[model samples]
Target: MCEIGGGMNFKRREFLRIVIDAIDGKTESIVVAHKDRLCRFAFDLVETLVNRSGCQIIVANQSKNAPQQELVEDMLAIIHCFSCRIYGSRHYAKEKVKAKRKYC
Candidate 1:
C-alpha cells in the first residue's frame, strides 16, 4: 500500500496495523514505493516476517533504478560532516589555547 511518510500529522498506525494483519495471515503481499519511504531505516522487521511467515515483499523502486547522483551527493555530504567534526575540534582547541596565552 502507498502512503506519505512525513508531515505535521504523520501517522504510522496504519502501517503497524497492516503488519499485524499480515502476521495474522490476512494479507500476503506488501508493495511499497521504497523501503526508506515507510521508515528511514526499519526494514529488518519486514524481512524477518518474510523469512518466518513467507510473505512476499514487492518494492516498486528497485535498487538499480535509484539515481547515482543521489548516492554521490549523500556520500559527499557525509564526508563534509566528518571533515567538519575533525577540523572543528582542532580549531576550537587552537582558539582556546590562543585565548589563554599572551604570546608564543
Candidate 2:
C-alpha cells in the first residue's frame, strides 16, 4: 500500500488516476493518512478495481475487509457534496457582488 498524497497536496483527479492506474496493473493499493484522504470516489473506484483489475485496496488506517468502508464512503460523499455547494454559493455571491458594483 503506497500513500499517495498529503492532506494539502491531494487532488481528486490525481487520486482517481492513481487508483485507475493501480487497477490497470500499474500498481497495488493506494495508501493514505485516513479514509477521507481518498475522498468521495473511493466506493466507485473500489468497485471498478474489483471488477476490472482484480485489485484490492488497503487503507492503512482501516483493516482489510473492514465493514466501515460503506459508511466512510457515504460520509465522504456527503462532505464533498456539501463543499461543492458551499463553493458554488460563494462563487455566485462573488459574481453578484461584482455585477452590482459594476452597475452601480
Candidate 3:
C-alpha cells in the first residue's frame, strides 16, 4: 500500500482491498496525495470502476501544471524511456550482428 508506483511489480494488497470494498459498497471515499499515487497508470480505470460503485475519489494535491505542460512532460518522459531502452540495447545488437557475420 505504501510502495512506490514506478512499475506493476509490487504487491497491491491494500489497493485491491479498497477496490473490492468499493465494489461491495463498503467504502465511501478514497483520498490520496495525488491521483497517480493511488494508481500510476490506471487512475482513469480505477476511478471509473469506483465511481460506478458509488465511491468517491479525492486528490489532495491537485496538479498545478497546465494540461499542455503536463502532456508535454509525459510525452518527453515516454520518449526518454524508449530512447534509453533502444540505446541500451545497441551493444547487444552489435554483438548479434557480429556473431551473424562470423557465421556467414
Model number with the top lDDT: 3
lDDT of 2 by residue, 1-104 (tens): 34444333335567667766876788755566555566544455464664476566555786464568767856676787678779999999999999999999
Model 1 Cα lDDT, one tens digit per residue, 1-104: 45554311224777777677777777788787766555443466665775466577677986654578657755675676578779989999999899889565
Per-residue lDDT, model 2, residue 76, is 73
Against the true structure, candidate 3 reaches a TM-score of 0.59
Q: Could you tell me the lDDT of residue 39 within candidate 3?
A: 63
User: Superposing all C-alpha atoms, what RMSD in Å does each candidate have to the true structure?
Assistant: 9.6, 5.7, 5.3
Candidate 3 residue-wise lDDT, 66-96, digit = tens: 9898788667756776787799799889999
Off by over 4 Å in 3: 4-11, 72-104
Which parts of model 1 have CA positions greater than 4 angstroms off? 7-11, 65-104
lDDT of 2: 0.64
Distance (Å) between predicted and true CA of 37, model 3? 0.4
Order of all candidates by TM-score, from best down to worst? Answer: 3, 2, 1
List TM-scores for all candidates, in order: 0.50, 0.52, 0.59
Candidate 2 to truth, TM: 0.52
C-alpha lDDT score of every prediction, in listed order: 0.65, 0.64, 0.77
**Local error of candidate 1 at residue 1 (angstroms):** 4.6
